[model samples]
Target: MVQSLAGMMVPADIFLSWGVQFPSVLATVAEKAAEAAEADGTMVLLAVLLSLVAIYTASKVGGEFFNWLGFPPVLGELVGGVVIGVSAFNLVVFPETGGNADNSLIMLVLSATAGLDPSVAEPTFEVQSEVVSILAELGVIVLLFEIGLESNIRQLLEVGVQSLVVAIVGVVAPFVAGTVGLIAVFHVAPIPAIFAGAALTATSIGITSRVLAEIGRLSSKEGQIILGAAVMDDVLGIIVLAVVASLAKTGEVDVTNIIFLIISASVFLVGAILLGRFFNDTFVALAEQFQTRGRIVIPAFILALLLAYVAAAIGLEAILGAFAAGLVLDETEPGKELEELTKPISDVLVPIFFVTVGTKTNLSVLNPAVPENRAGLVIASFLIVVAILGKLISGFSVFGVENINRVAIGVGMIPRGEVGLVFASVGSESGALSPSLDVAIILMVILTTFLAPPLLRVVFRDEEPEAAEPDTPA
Candidate 1:
């Protein structure tokens, strides 16, 4: 029977008829299935999963490639994001449709079946994009927490007057440069100018610390000063961000509110440190009794998240809380173990945050042919120059510290990295900065982040090599 059925030759007309009907039937079935899935909200889940796969794959490959090239892995991740994002390949897109709407495979499939125009259709927010955005935010929180874990409050105190001077100068100079350059030179409004300046006050400890560690100079005197100054910069930067953000929201800067915010922020940080110290032993003891896996790590992570929530609740950036949690967790008996466990988590999330930041950057404004884009490029150029010079001058602030490569320190402080991105994101969301200004800020961030690592390597080449050691807190 099988042989008879296999050997049966269909008539040419019948064969042609089946072949034509097959695709039509299959397409009909698929269309119905898709409609059913949409009704059940399954399409949203599928889209989200697809997005995650795409984002993580792109970020990992990009990060690894950059690492191989001897640059910071984050730079590679950022570049990769730009390559795959709407501004480049259009592999991923947001709710709005236009431009590369036709280029995105997912968008194409949806648009075709829905009878939507790729160019003119208004797309609704997919569940997947929202989830991706939330995860990206959590990634930043984890990144800040990891930074805090590596920091030692005692070491920060030990760096003393030199670090203090450097930190102050670093924060103030950039703030002045950004504000003055935008307002006086670019003729930007006062509120937006303030936001731009606040962005410059940020110094990415993660970038500078990683560079120093890679060069085996993390424990050097200059490294110590840079770390200490970075810590101070984080504190000052957050305060400035809070004040400026408040001003942007209220349309006025209240002196009383600014002073209160500064005091509140300081008290919260110090209080968190003291509270963590007091509870460290108790938490460790409790963790030891838990027979289940991830005892120490789980509890520590919860603490970080809890603090982050509290910080956000109190009108401060959640990163400050995450940092404080790390500081506190560092004092635990299982601190080293917690750090080891947390490293893998950070390894996954941190790159996602960086890549997401890169993807959000609109490269269209940087085009030179368009008159408006030309103006934006000019503004970006001026901002980049100011950003570079502002931090460069801070390296010379340490007058009393001898034998320290001030140039290296200055270069070390130059990369704004994730911190600047955060500042710009906040400013844009709050409507404090115009789209052009935001793009300019991102350009400044990208240039500074990319420039610092190479410049630091060059500046440190003449110095004697320091022995590689485990990271110590500062």
Candidate 2:
């Protein structure tokens, strides 16, 4: 066989193998290699940008589609995330989602292509990343602050027993369930399992709020209970996160640290509320005096940033500070303007946060061929069911509230939104939970989020009162 030397060429697989082997070579050629490596980083950023754009556009498109089909818009968002996440389309690379991504083909490509030249791969701030962090923070702040501002303080006061019951069940069930599941089923150590349980204790109010708003049930009595219970849940979640962090760091749970965190969080929350109330008048006056439009925005931004820092210093999340700031603003007479101004920032920052979340969901964990992996998958499903059922039972707390649909309220409380993701992220970063556990948590969040709207619609279809029948003049 006389074959010309030119006739034989490098196989496509060989070129890929070469890229994997001599990563630096691709970056060194004519500096084309370097430029190309640099280009990949740029490509990553571009992919993120495109993801953000896709999510936003998808949300809109999904919303319309769902609206037309009489389904929840959130469902559409979930579908959008899943569709983009899976192999149906390869528009964006799914970032490592704990254990699941390592098995993914997309990640295989990302790993093979990761910064070919370390010399040229120095991380730089993309406008997108900054914008994403800010919006995510702002949206969270607005959401929490709005909850505080909109809180029916008087109703909470009046129905103290009910609120406490709801909060207690909501916190205790998940905590206990998660711990037992980890220890008994997964055979994880008790301490990590406890921390895992604590992570699951926090109820994400944002999901329920959005669902209620979507179904036009936000003003109902059941809605109020859901809101109250969720706020209480957030307070509980923070306490749990602080405790778990202390335990993880010290390698032993400390009652003293728990007490200290509770005290600190309580003081911060109460002080912020009082300060906001006290300064409500002053803030209004200052807003009027400054009149610079620009002045108010800057001052507000500074305040948010300052509080966020202080919150961090006190060993709490910075998002809490932003939320507290929102509450303070809500008390001021000029709050409406502040809300309007905050919207643009939210519009810009929030989507990045969400898409960033979606980006982290690794689809490869779904593979069962990996060893001990079946246990992880089973755990994921078990956890999701436990998470859902536990929250669903909390709806029974509306014992005497008039015109309340306990079912609707319970259903409304089902969705776990950004806050759930926060817990999952904390779990992943701290190594308290493995990628398998991460998959479990994420599945719970997605399931809850996907179920809320449609379930709420079903529960509220008849508009029956939330309360059981009362005795007549007995």
Candidate 3:
């Protein structure tokens, strides 16, 4: 390719394409040779790989330290990302986060050692950052799929009415309180406030459920209530996101499109699960015939990714499809085996999701010394208060269970997790949220996420711990 493109100014994408094979020290050195051959071309592959190195290093170190302290490892990963991301080290900064070749340490390392040209640094960082972003997105998808696999639909159904009430209140309370407060009190516009309210509706089922599993309460009655409600929250959150996204995009709400999203999302989730169940035996029989290394896992992976794509294509989040696929496959005979096999993949990919969320956060706005930042802090405080109080009240809405852990249920739903980041990103990209408001939303997300796990441990500490469900596999 270098020989073919010689004497032409090589595009950044050529290096990006070669980035499919992850770069090594050898690859970095080889890139110097390639640079020699194609004088006009510069390598971004090394920069990209080095960024991932920083990401993984931060994830593991933070995760381990947090695990040691008896907090969620995912929280540590987020903090580690903040330390290395735009907020601190600049080693893992993204283009959207005011990071560029001039600011990124990894890109500088490449320019110094890998012969990456200074002139192409920005373009290189753009491609490299976009790749990292895509990986982070995939990480969340895998995390949700894993959550789905672990979940028992029967348990969710057993607590269906309570979960429904909790989910509805959990969503409505935060949304109404946030939107109205932002508008009537803060004087923010209706659209941006609505978007912010929608952001509040997310319950990071990934992190919350992960915490429940880590603490051995995952199959408890309270845990089941939280899980079922979180799933419902995911569905309802999508509808709210769609409505706001449409309003933001066109400045006019499309009621017709909104209805379609609601119907399609419902039908897609139910139909996918039903279809997966109907075909489970056939899938198992075909896998039994293969006797191959990845016979079960590979097909399961394909189904997950395929369904994820379908969900996204039909105007819902891709994670929904991946999750539905997991729920379906969990009912199959080889479910446990497939889950064990899938763990390694989830371990490799899911940290990227948590860490990147931290990386994109600029908590610098919360500083009290800066007068402009003070306003953001005020708004952030308002949001943080409403966000916590609003969701915390959701547990009381759960009806008719003896000695039910209402506080535990509310605390479980407090973490908006990565899904809140999705809402903020959408609003930011669509110009719906002002920078101050954006920072406020981010603060709400980060604090809520970081606070949930320890709070869960604290809330459930006094209760007689419920035994794990007999049918639910660890």
Candidate 4:
């Protein structure tokens, strides 16, 4: 429109003769305004705001439903993400502005307008993407640290062989089954298949822990085993991610690098154990010295973040570092005070982290026009079975541990919340997965997380009778 006005004008001298320059000024202002608007787009910001509102509302409704159904709120959170991304209630806009429905092209154009040349843009964006990614890394660290603090290290060690076996089975079975489904069944190449299996490897210990605590079984032997197995599962899962990621990047899975990652994780685990034992007295002393209000809590919080950062710096995930730090803290103090102090922080930040996960989910990937899709859904369905069965087999690991039904504990720990989704996201970002494949992983995650709790309630309902009757008469 502004160009039309400029074209219609014969000459500025005509306006000057009439002593009115308003038309020329209007044209210049309009042209500049249009140019500026095009340059500085607010599309992403608007889309984010829309998503935030939608997520908040969905979380509330989803939370209630999941809670009533005997599941964790994380299940609802996952569903909330799925609703926004895949269901009729999509919260995201295609271009996030304008009527253009081609988001991929829009993203490319917007990124190009921001000075990223197409040839160089992929690498540049991958590098810059690390900034937002640090958030998830931190979340994992904090989650693990909390687990460490809640853990009974001595007890976990006592149960080490059994827990290790469970963890190994938990990791291997799912990976093999999932890989076979992706490759033999779905016929994808080995590298991508391995990536899919890797995504299925994580077990959300946090979700399992919360549910165990809720059911007053945190003190049970079965609970202890589940917690221990989950810790090991995370350690092993990350190693798989590192190896698979390297393989995907280089097209060669280096056995030496895989061995090195495993060794590093083992070294870190051992180092954490020694440090916790050696400095436990010092930690207790420091807490005593800082008994003053507003002292121990802040320092401890700082310690968690510091360790988390250091972990990231070393190429390991921050969540693992946070968990290690928490393990090092002196939990011998009465009433689990360290955990009580940290709960407030976790309560506030953790939900935001999960909600952000929900926000990133794009549901439109289920659209029919998406390419190379059959394999993705087929693999996801197969892996969902493998994910459930692998954890279920952990129940058999309870043999010879008296008074506890290992089956129940295994079922309780089956839900894969943020951890599994994190794997899916990493795969998606690396270009190793198609959009439909990403959706399949998301669906598998949602299915596993949603089904676990209610199933657990039924599986363990029989345990009450065994508990009621002691082996020896009272």
Return the TM-score for each candidate structure.
Answer: 0.83, 0.71, 0.82, 0.70
- Which residues of candidate 2, in runs, are more than 4 Å off? 1-119, 122-160, 190-195, 202-220, 245-252, 398-405, 462-474
Candidates' C-alpha lDDT:
0.75, 0.60, 0.78, 0.61
Model 2 lDDT at residue 472 = 14
Q: How would you encode candidate 3's per-residue C-alpha lDDT over 135-234 as one tens digit per residue?
A: 8778878877886787666666776799999999999999999999998988988889989999999887777777787677888878888988987887
lDDT-sorted candidate list, best first: 3, 1, 4, 2
lDDT of 2 by residue, 298-365 (tens): 66667666776677666665566766676666656666677667666755555444444454555566
lDDT of 4 by residue, 146-225 (tens): 66676556656676677788888888877888888788777777777888888777787777766565555655677778
Give the C-alpha miss distance for residue 134 in model 4, angstroms: 5.4
Residue 257: error of model 3 in Å? 3.2
On lDDT, the leading prediction is 3
What RMSD does each model have against the real structure? Answer: 13.4, 11.7, 7.2, 13.4
The residue-by-residue lDDT of candidate 1 on 119-206, one tens digit each, is 3322222434545666777888888788777776777778899888888999999898879878898798888998999898888888
Q: How does model 2 score by TM-score?
A: 0.71
Tell me the number of clashing residue pairs for each predicted model: 1, 7, 0, 6
Which residue runs of candidate 1 sit more than 4 Å off their true CA positions?
A: 1-40, 96-104, 109-124, 214-216, 468-474
Q: By summed lDDT, which 10 consecutive residues of candidate 1 come out lowest?
A: 1-10
